[model samples]
Target: MGGLIFWKLRGSDEKPVASVQPPPPATTPQVFEQPPPPPPPPPPPEEDAGKKPAGKVVGVGGGGCAGECKGTAGATLQSALAAKAGAARGCYERGLRQNATLQGKLVISVRVGPGGQVCSAGVASNALGDPGVASCVVGLFRSASFPAPEGGCVDTQVPMNFVPKGGGK
Candidate 1:
């Protein structure tokens, strides 16, 4: 099955299971007076495959939009969730305008303990370019929490898109 990994791998040295594939050399060298150059050679196997592909990382900082994360309970908790959504939108929009190649959505599930503490957090949905920004967001929500609404448990899902506003750079 296809699974997502939201890991804090910044500066994490890559441990190649196999040899790294080198990119194909450009066949078309634009030399004036020279005939049109040939097409570039095919890239080597997995030349462009790896963690954190060429894409912008859109960070999200809220939970609540679909109410599928934190359990639903009271007005304060609901309001906090709404606030979280707005924050996520801001972060996404900022990333989009930066000419970054964003093309995915990430949903972060924040778990609030009985005492209204952020006890745990995980990625709910990682797709498109979603997983790219998960690590950064982990720290953003580490200190966040919403009181358990009085009704049932509350689990909020805050999703952010990584698709750049324009195509890509």
Candidate 2:
């Protein structure tokens, strides 16, 4: 009766189809991964870590021209002026030709923009006794380039001394 039932199900006298096979076992052994070790603890703060807070000024002396300038801005301006020293000297010499007695200091106040550009410059003090020389010095400073300062702008003064080529009155 079982054979008759099988024949009825297949409805043919052909050999029965091979049974479906299960997938082969994995050749490599499975790995049980361990979670990564906890991250290292943060380093301890230094003794002088909080000496100067991120945004506060500690002391007020170490800066440009009586603490008027700060950071690399002062150095940047100094170097820029130093680079153009020849031009400034030329201006002074020209003024000397006009008046052989031209000898003194010219203090220039400069305003530097945030993008390392000279916004404006003017003669703060002029002991040279010549407006032409003062104006020329101010123009030279205005054309100078400095490194961008951290703050919005930098206001600083530079003094240039002019001495007569020949020591005379």
What TM-score against the true fold does each predicted structure earn? 0.43, 0.52
Cand. 1 TM to true fold: 0.43
lDDT of 1 by residue, 1-169 (tens): 1232324353255565787789998799777787888999997657555312222111122432223444454678667755665566545665456535656767787765444555456777777454435655654665677765554345666665555545543
State the displacement of the C-alpha of residue 111, model 2, in Å, after optimal TM-score superposition: 0.8
Please provide, for model 2 over 94-167, each residue's C-alpha lDDT reduced to its tens digit, 9 standing for 90 to 100.
89889987898888887665556665688888888999988887788777777766654577677777897667
Candidate 1: give its CA RMSD in angstroms.
32.1
In candidate 2, where is summed lDDT lowest over 10 consecutive residues?
A: 53-62
What does the lDDT read for residue 62 in candidate 1?
42
